[model samples]
Target: MKLNKHTVATRYAKAYYNLAEEHDCIKEAFDNMMDIRQIFGENPGLGLVLSDARLTLAQKRPIVDNLIKNFPELMQNFVLMIFDYDRMGDMELIVDEFEKLYDHKNRTILAKVTTAVPLTEAQKTRLADVFVKKLDGKKVIFDEVVDPEILGGVIIEAEHQIFDGSIRLNLETLKKQIAK
Candidate 1:
């Protein structure tokens, strides 16, 4: 059987998660993963450089070392292993998978909210509170996106569900009804 990218990433993520748990450093691992994820996300070129096929481990090690200069020894080693395996391209996916595993273990959910306008801190807190309740009181981690095309209202994505209250969507619905 051929293992796909997701399977490979998940395997690595689980292994790292287990190692962290065994060392009682899950929190530290989680924080480090977030930091690494953000770095990779913000600098796609860095991911490409680390994952470049022509680069030997010796070549990659220095780059990895510089990038993770202040990282905990465990995380630095784990990241180096990914580069060693030529799986640096999958770093983002691995981080995502790790977050999913951590969130599941912690009974938390990540919510993505898109709105036509920027939300105030109070609004964000209220939205989180509502989502927390909607998610059966699980802790909610919110990621907000501003999309003026929505015209008005908000759209939420959580646990494979979409709650769209956007004016654009409502207008489309009304249009369909009028056509009928």
Candidate 2:
């Protein structure tokens, strides 16, 4: 039986999250993971290099060690374990799963909001307030996107739901109604 990437990542992340919680270092672990994710993002080839079959664990140890030298002992061990298990390629997925656990623990929701223009701080606050109620009071964090193609109104995607109130969509609806 072959486990998928997500399953492997979730198992590792859940175990890591539990360990961090036990050590009372969840925040620190989360911060370090975010930084590590950024590092992976900035260096797209890092994962490939670490996962290369030609490079033995001894050769990859120094690189991984140097990259995470400043992190706490828990995180250091976690990274080493992942590397030791040849799961370096799934580091990003692990980080993402860890983030989801962190957010759920903190009662936070990440909403991707798209609008025709940039929203003011006031608008953002109001939007968040509205979504907060809809989301059963989870603190809302906006990932704002500006797309002129929407023409007007807003489109919100969060928690596997999409609230598309864009003018373009409304116009299409109207056109269909007229045709009918």
Candidate 3:
């Protein structure tokens, strides 16, 4: 059977998360994963090189080792294992899944907030406070976006739900009501 990337990533992330939990180094592990994600993101070709069939493990090992030399021993071993399993191409997905697990465990929610203009620090704080109450007291982290097309008002997306209060949406709703 062929396992999809998400399934593979989830499995690896869960295993790593469990290991981190067992060793009581969840925060450190999370930080290391973030660093790895950043490295892959900044050097997009690195994953491609690591996943290339032409490059033998011996050739890849030095690269992987250099990249992770400063990381904790457990993280270094975990990354080596990923390379061993030939899943280096899916490293980003694994990191994403690990982040989701970490956030859930920490009771943190990442909310994407869109506004016609950038929010001030005070506004951000207020929005986060409101979302915390709405999201069952989970700590809210904003991924703020500004889009003038919204015309006015805010649109918040969190936990698979969208709270759209944008003027554009409101105008559309009003137009529909008038047509009705």
Best candidate (score: TM-score): 3
What are the per-residue Cα lDDT tens digits for candidate 1 across 15-89? 999999999999999999999988987887887888887977788888888888999999988988897788888
Q: Model 3: per-residue lDDT, tens digit, 126-158? A: 989988898885799889899999999999999
Best first by lDDT, ranked: 3, 2, 1
**By TM-score: ranked, best first:** 3, 2, 1
lDDT of each: 0.91, 0.93, 0.94
TM-score, model 1 to reference = 0.77
What TM-score against the true fold does each predicted structure earn?
0.77, 0.90, 0.94
> By TM-score, is 1 or 2 better?
2
How much does candidate 3 score in TM-score? Answer: 0.94
- When 1 and 2 are scored with lDDT, the better candidate is 2
Native-vs-model 2 lDDT?
A: 0.93
Give the C-alpha miss distance for residue 2 in model 3, angstroms.
0.7
